[model samples]
Target: MNESMEAGMEQYLTAGAAGAVAGLGVAVPLGAVGVLVLQQAMRDRRAGAAAGAAVAVVDAGYAALATAVGPLVAAALAGVEAWVRLVAALVLAVIAALGLLASRRPAPAGTTGTAGTETAAPARVFVRFAALTFVNPTTALYFAALTTAQGDTLRGGAAGAVFTFGVFAASLLWQQTLVVAGGFAGPRLPDRARVWTFRAGYGLVAGYAVTVALPLPAL
Candidate 1:
């Protein structure tokens, strides 16, 4: 291979690697979304996988946006940070309340006691999580900072595509791990344990709502 082409390939590989690392950094912290995903997994693997994919898509989209026009979005958000947080908090609070209520109830008649049975559709779950994850402006800022640090490695063309794909793939991989763990653990847990676990997950989500509203440090 020619020297210039070899150098380009190396750069693309490096960008992909960097993007994957950044994705893991973003996803591994087990925040509110992560907690919810795990809880969903315990109820139904398909639903959980759908939610996880949504998160990955949003994360990759935010990363791409951060690389392309982060400064502008950041600047715009700064003017309405409080309002944004308020909306996000309200949404999260509602989700937590609904989740908690759902946990308390039994599965609908004639259906299995799983999210797959109760959730209506995996596509719906995906849309819901995609919207939820997209509301967090912090994610975009995070990618923005990383992209800035990366300098030209994350610029347009082949590098950008590889980086974005890497982010999506890595995030999905981590989410799948959570789903698998939750799925396995769910079957083994006692009935009471399962209910309590769901409660705990929703409770954590509630806590996240409060933190987001307060604009405090969060996972």
Candidate 2:
């Protein structure tokens, strides 16, 4: 029994390492969502950290689903991809509009409010990030492909759980790094520069949303 348990533990560790690699592979790409995460970090490290956590949570959830029932999840996602993209695009547009409006507002008094006007509630940040991440069907598809390619080695039971945990951990680490870097750089920028950066970020996000909504050829 002890030997069997030890072997299982070893398998879980191996699966976990694989999951970590997969997580980093997906998270390292500086997409619109990633840029927004950096923007959040620039405003407040805590908010950025929360956004990072939310991203990890969504990634882990997708990883877990893929590990458990990859083919089924993939099929479901394929069926709903169009609708999901539409919803995601609309949500991003709304967010972008809000950001643009906020950026145009005059700065309050003498203080340089790097944190901006958005509430820094971790829960709100987490939910926002999670919703943003979840709407992208590609994330789910990516997890499904990764898990399916790995075969049975990383599928189901304790091994799957460990793998999902690893994904969450690695993603969280990457996000934290972004948050820290953004926080470090945000305070140094002049008010005008910061405002312009915010506008640029909003425009980029809006562009990404429109791109997602369109049926463009995948790069």
Candidate 3:
């Protein structure tokens, strides 16, 4: 019995490490979401931290769900993938437009410091980031694919739980790193440079949205 328990623990740890790798694989890509996180961090460290946490929360939730019911969810979403992609693209475009508009606005009076021109409340920032992350079905689809591919390792129960926990922990670590890095660099940048960064970030997001909205060629 002791030997069996030890083997089970070993399996759990192995599965967890695999999950962390999968999480990092998905999170390391610096896309629209990454740019938004960095922009928020540059504006206000608190908001940046909140945004990062929110993204991590969504990622963790999606990872858990994918591990738990990946096959069923993927099957269900397969039929409507195009529509979901379109909706996600539209949402991203709107967010990019809003960010561009916000960037163009002048900083308010009496707001002096490296805090930048943060107009949104912390709670609002968290919710907005969370919602934006959730709307991108690709995150869920990526997890589902990973879970489906790792059938043997993620055979449910304690191993699955440990794997999910590892994914969440890894994602949080990556996001917090981005937040910290952005916060550190933000203060050093001049106001004009910051504005250009915002514009560039928003423009990139719009480009990403357009790419998502475009149809893929048949294989």
Candidate 4:
């Protein structure tokens, strides 16, 4: 999948092989998210605490959009998210690299999370997703474009809105929780384990990029 310019993100935005079910695939990145939460917690205990709940809120919005607009819209506009993702892999790698580098940066003695303020994970993972999903420029606008593409499908008005909300609730809750759990598990890891996890995670992400670059089916 070639990365589209909708929101500057392309690679990981595709739905699952199961159509709407594919939306849940977003949860798989919890490993990387774990690293972020762990580091954020160590820096600012508060940010880490509230991270999860915030994420759920962000996810709910995306879920709503995904449902109201319909995946078909995104599919039609982008045409094969796998291809779009393939291109976006490079962009994702850049983001991941930035995160890894920032992760390595030493915080000041009193600094906490990246934002300086911290909170416990929200009541649920979906809350975190709902709050944080749009923090990324790509996902935000891309989803909007997909929504616009719906046209008649969106005319269902409240019904469409409700459907979108249901889809979002279902998809985001399932996906965002992965990040919450990852944050909670971070501190328990040993130094060596954490390092290796980073190495392996980046390596796998890199490998995935290579695969995406190839003309293979956009899995």
Q: Pick the candidate with the highest TM-score.
A: 3
Please state the error at residue 165 of candidate 2 in Å. 0.5
Runs off by more than 4 Å, candidate 4: 1-63, 66-83, 110-155, 175-180, 202-204, 211-213, 216-219
- Give one digit per residue, the lDDT tens place, for model 2 in 55-145: 9999999999899999776676775676777777888888889888887766565543553444358789899899888877668879999
lDDT of 4 at 24: 47
Per-residue lDDT, model 3, residue 144, is 90
lDDT of 1: 0.82
TM-score of 1: 0.89
Q: Ranking under TM-score, best-scoring first?
A: 3, 1, 2, 4
lDDT of each: 0.82, 0.83, 0.83, 0.46
Residue 172 in model 2: lDDT? 88
**Worst 10-residue lDDT window, candidate 1:** 111-120
TM-score (C-alpha) between model 3 and the true structure: 0.92
Q: Write the per-residue lDDT of candidate 3 for residues 1-219, one digit (tens) a residue.
A: 999999988998898898789778877898888888898888888888889889888888888888789998888877677777888899999988988887777777867433235556779999999998898877888889988898857847888888888888888899889999999988899988888888888899899888887784233
TM-score of each: 0.89, 0.86, 0.92, 0.49
Assess candidate 2 and give its TM-score to the true structure. 0.86
Per-residue lDDT, model 2, residue 162, is 93
Instruction: Give model 4's clash tally.
Output: 41
